[model samples]
Target: MNNYYILGLDIGSVNISAAIAKFSPDSDNLSISGIGRARTNGLKKGVVTNIEKASTSIRQAAKEAMKTAGCKPDRVVVSIAGAYTGSVKSQGIVSVPSGEISINEIKRAMQMAQDNAIIDKDQVILHVLPYEFKVDGQDHIEDPIGMSGSRLEVFTHVITAEGNSIRNLIKATNMAGLKIDNMVLAGYASALATLTKDEKELGVGLIDLGGATCDIVVHLGNSIVYNDTLPVGSTNITMDLSRALNTPLANAEEIKINYTKLLESGVSELQLPTMGEVSLTHEASMDIVTKVIYARIEETILLLLNKFENSGYLNKLGSGLVLTGGMSKLDDIRNLTSLMFDNIPVRIAKPRSVDGLFEVSEDAKNSCVVGLCLYGSGEFTRYEIDSNGELKYKDSHLKSMTSTKSVNSAPVIEKEKVEYKEDKSEDLIKISKISEKNAEDMHTFTKILNRLKQLF
Candidate 1:
């Protein structure tokens, strides 16, 4: 067996997370090189704004990861999430003339549905999750690949993204000098690293709380059935603190991370930063802490849970809530999850059984990026590609493989004639527009400074 090294990167509005790991054929273990995180620039609310800034940060991140993993970059799978990603379940049915049907016919019928997929001009398909397949009039047939059937029906989950979202991401990665070998959704990455076989089988709700956005994914009966994202998270809490206490964003972040607790830590007022660990005491203004955070986190959870409930298939909370990400690290968040989710178990999901996790026991906090690397290294080998530009799968993307939901993996669209020819006309126009924008920004900055001087 050949040894393969994998790099996973999760890019967010506030931070860039990178991890490097190599797999050996001799063992089922992974050697984690290092994990790198840095404040993000050039992106806003999960979308790339300035390619130069994003690329610079990304380049630095890659270099840092390389140093940690002790290996130069070879391949990387980038993780993405944002507003433009939409998920839907579509089904196709066809009658087979013979009493028995081969896997080829069922698969071909599903392909016909995918062919008619609503791929718009500004969007690209990211995933094709198969929910269930039926034979003849039978329902919930797991795999029809070899089963005999007169009629084949497949239920699938199709995920699509805004073309510009991916285009800008690819552009930034290219500029940063990383090969865009694969693109995986941030939710999928987190699930891969956190959710277990039983959880996916019974149903699991994985919520990733990041700086600027919150990604929610529910895996029921072992495959992803529902996914929804909201444009708010830890950063909003930071902003609230900043505006409330008249402090810089950096200072507010410090307060939230070090002082804030899920429930009242029996204290209200806590120091911004006291050298190291925050000592929780009765004298601490527990009210103040909860007052600041409860509403913010409460509202966030309510909105997200409500969205999941509305989905019908996700409200049951079968596997409970597994919260991850930087924001999920807030002390006692598990308590809040219980109050908000009710009856369903809520626990912090950590990345166990992966290499280099000893430095941080809370691997779930960075689960998405790390999981991306693990899954990128053949963990999501549910996809198959043959000669010609055709992509085939054993089942739809949402079907569970083991006891858990077996996501078909990110869909592969056959490479087409990429018109990479330089758009000289558009390039020239873009340059002029960029120059004009820069000049306008400088003028605005100067105006603000002048106004401040006048006030002083």
Candidate 2:
């Protein structure tokens, strides 16, 4: 039995969360062993402002999680915010040399697509997800491995991030005594944890509203097609409240949480302390508080709505929109969102299920962290490009499948027997067996060539 531990860390502007999942290779279930969170101090709008403070927060979260799990995880799967992320769609084509497509042909096409993408010099590719495939004159071919085709073309959505920002995150994690197995987009991670397979296939939009940033992701046909971020979030509302009501930021946040409701409410008045002079107290109207919160939230939703409309995926979201994160817990957020989104179906969501820790699954704020665990436990794409930009096969964790076999169980195909002529007049014959999985470990040449200067 190959039972392993996967540690997922989501370091955001408001909080740094860590969760440990115990997974068995033979089963589809992921058991949550522990979870921990700490207030973040070194981040502003999800970008690390100070590596030392970020590392301290990461250490605190990881240490607490490990202590609860009674074991230290060697490598962690971390989530990167969408603030520094960008995505582009590209296509690659190659002739089928053997008149049939194989893994090599597929890899070549994906590498060509990566090469075709135009990006800034300071950015690194984070994910290369294939959304469509064309074989010869045919279009939308899912897998053309065994199909006869003269040319194989693949359309992929590539996600990239600023190199400096990624390096800073990596450095902070390393300082926290954790090696990163992968870095996933926080938006994509949240979608993975909250979205059902049917929703992905039918097209769905997910928004993760965090403390200082709102991350957007559109999923269609089992892959993310678009990813974006907004600099405004729940913190903006708090600031607006502080300014509008002439109150301290702490008190403003409390009011936003407890008093303000987007919908109508009867609680009309509250005793509020002055901003600079807390000793002096005054009565504040709940109507003003509600309006302040509503304005900021409405602005945020409109910005997100505009972004989605411009992405060309607005009409494609047949399954509608799903909202998660800390701000989604705000009173009447779903009702307000539905009204803003033209009454299209809107649902406030969190992690769909968590085996051990109920708290993690209960709160929408923990979506990204739980999704990181799912991603780490092989609950993502079948083929993925690792952080090192190598093509790797990931076993699907779907429960509907009859088998949960991994690459280690891949079939070994015997090579054709060969005979060698020797000068000694004796013929040597040999047969060799090679595993199909071994041939899939090919490096992405485009990334390697682009980063060759860094290797020196």
In order, the Cα lDDT scores of the candidates are 0.66, 0.77
- Give per-model TM-scores: 0.79, 0.84
Which portions of model 1 miss their true places by more than 4 Å? 94-107, 260-286, 381-417, 421-456
lDDT of 2 by residue, 1-456 (tens): 556677899988888999998876676678889888898978777788898899899999998999898876634689889999998787777788688888878778777776666666656778888888888879867667678878888888888877668767766776676666678889988998999888888999999999999999999884788999999889899899889888899988887777535234567787888989959988888778878887888999999999998999999999999999999998888999999999989989989787888878999999999999888677776555544455655533333122332211111112223233323333232222211221135357735753442222
Per-residue CA lDDT of model 1 for 47-69, tens digit only, reads 88998899888888888988887
* Highest TM-score model number: 2
